[model samples]
Every structure is written in structure tokens, then in C-alpha cells.
Target: MTSPSTHHTTITSDPTVPLVRIVREFDAPAEKVFRAHTDPELVTRWLGPRGLEMRVEHYDCRTGGSYRYVQAENGEEYWFHGSFHEVRPSERIVQTFTFEGYPDAVALETLLLEDLGDGRTRLTTTSLVDSFEGRDAFVVSGMEVGVNEGYERLDELLAG
Candidate 1:
């Protein structure tokens, strides 16, 4: 028998600022979770929603580095690029994220991995956009589905 989603992903927005935060707890260590994010091949294995094919053009996930990738679904391609501003292995990363569909709306994003001990981790990410409207648009974009499903895939990767 299978259980409902026990590993919940909390997606919240700041009422006073143009920021969106995603928090999730995983049954894996911080190092493992961090590797799943930084390693390009592992990323391609589970970066977005299921049923999509992802191809990485360049994924240099290091300080001052950048990356670009394409995710295709049903003959449609979605492009996203980002530049890493800071990278602290197993701890935190700060980057700039841009979706090619709306090039002008770039966001500053930060990823934090907290060690919960006993082989567990807490991942927290915050994305800060330029305006409340931009943030609202992102919130309304049905991003939770992609994020929740992607994390489920990550759980499988970490388990295996």
C-alpha cells in the first residue's frame, strides 16, 4: 500500500516583498541532496515535471558560472538560463534565473540546504523578483505542480 505525499513541499509568498519561498524536507543527507542539484546529469534526470525531456546546453554549477537548458514537452520547448553568483557546497547557492519566454523578468534566487541530522535534510529556496506583479504572475503560473513533482523524482533519485 502507498501513502499520500508525506514529504510536503511548502510554497509560500511574502506579503510585503516580491519573494517566493519553497521549503521541503527530504529523507536524505544534505550532501546527497546537494549533489543531486549540482550534478548536471543527475539534474537532467529529475529537474522538472515528469513526462518532459531535458537537455542541458551548458551546466557549470559553480561560483560565477552559468547554465542553460531546454525542456521539451509535446513538441514545445521551454528554455531557462541562470548564472551562479555564489556556491557553497552542501550549504547554499545564490543565482540569477531567467526564463527565455520572458527574458526581461529575471529573478534572484537562493537555495539553502540544512542538515537535519540522522540522514535527513531540509531544502529551502527563495526567489526574489522585480515587482509584486511579477511575483504574482509566477505564483499563478501553476509552478507548484512542477516543483512538487520534481521533488518527488528527486526523492527517488536520492533513494536509489
Candidate 2:
């Protein structure tokens, strides 16, 4: 959850499965929210934590497409790549995520956007990894910092 914002992201880990589930509500239309995730320019604006600079080397957000990007801070860079398995406009996305630091650990991620009416959208994401240890590592890796910050920035983008 965000520390000081009106909107919050609820991140939960499943005890029986190697999954991380995130739920959040945004005060924006589903189209806008979906665009922020699919558009390379909009994604670069708010995809990572506050300090790091994000660069999308290439982003083709469509079914059967793949993307790669890098985020850097203090001379250290983090690279991530993924393949889009399904892309339903303004509704759902299924993808595979891999961090270059742990090449063997890949997570299948699913994102769903539900229109809550009145220009609000509920976003839910689930990431399923290979093992419980991998899930635990992801939860302890300061991921909340990036997730919350990125959503906060997205809230700002939506409002602006």
C-alpha cells in the first residue's frame, strides 16, 4: 500500500501457491490506465521507483510481442524482458516477466482491468513464479517500494 496517498495498492502473497497478487483502484478510465501500461512513453514515465531513470529499449505491447527495458540508478542498471502472451485492449494482459539478474526465474503475470464505472478502474495483477522460495525472494526484495511508487506516479499521471 502507498504510504501517503489516497489510492493504495494491496499486495498479497499466497500461502499455498507461488503467487503475488496486487489489487489497486485508480480514479481514471480503463482506457487511460491501460494505455499507461501499454504505451512505451507513458510506461517510461512511471514504471519504476522514484529515483531510478527508466528507459524502454523496445516495447511492443501486443499479443505475441516482447519487450525489454532498463532502469538505472547510481551507475547500476537493472534489466528486464518479457513476452506478451495475450493482449486484450483495456481489459486483460498475460505476460511472462524475467529479470536479467535472475535469468532462470521467470514469472507469469496476468493483469486485469475492470471498469468500476464513473471513470474509475480496478486493476488486479497476479504473478506466479516457479517456487515458493522465488515468491518469498520477490516479496523481500523491496518490491513494495517500486510498486507503490510506480502506482503513485500513475495516479499523478491520471490526474494530470
Per-residue lDDT tens digits of candidate 2, residues 1-160? 4345687799999999999999999999999999999999999988878999999889999999999999999999999999999999999999999999999999999999999999999999999999999999999999999999999989988887
Structure candidate 1, residue pairs in collision: none
**Candidate 2 Cα deviation (angstroms), residue 37:** 0.3
Output the number of the lDDT-best candidate. Answer: 2
Looking at candidate 2, the ten consecutive residues that score lowest on lDDT are 1-10
User: What is the C-alpha lDDT profile of model 1 across 6-66, one tens digit per residue?
Assistant: 6999999999999999999999999999999899999998898988999999999999999
- TM-score of each model, paired residue for residue: 0.97, 0.97
Give the alpha-carbon lDDT of every model.
Answer: 0.93, 0.95
Candidate 2 clashing pairs? none
RMSD of each: 1.4, 2.1
Backbone clash total for model 1 is 0
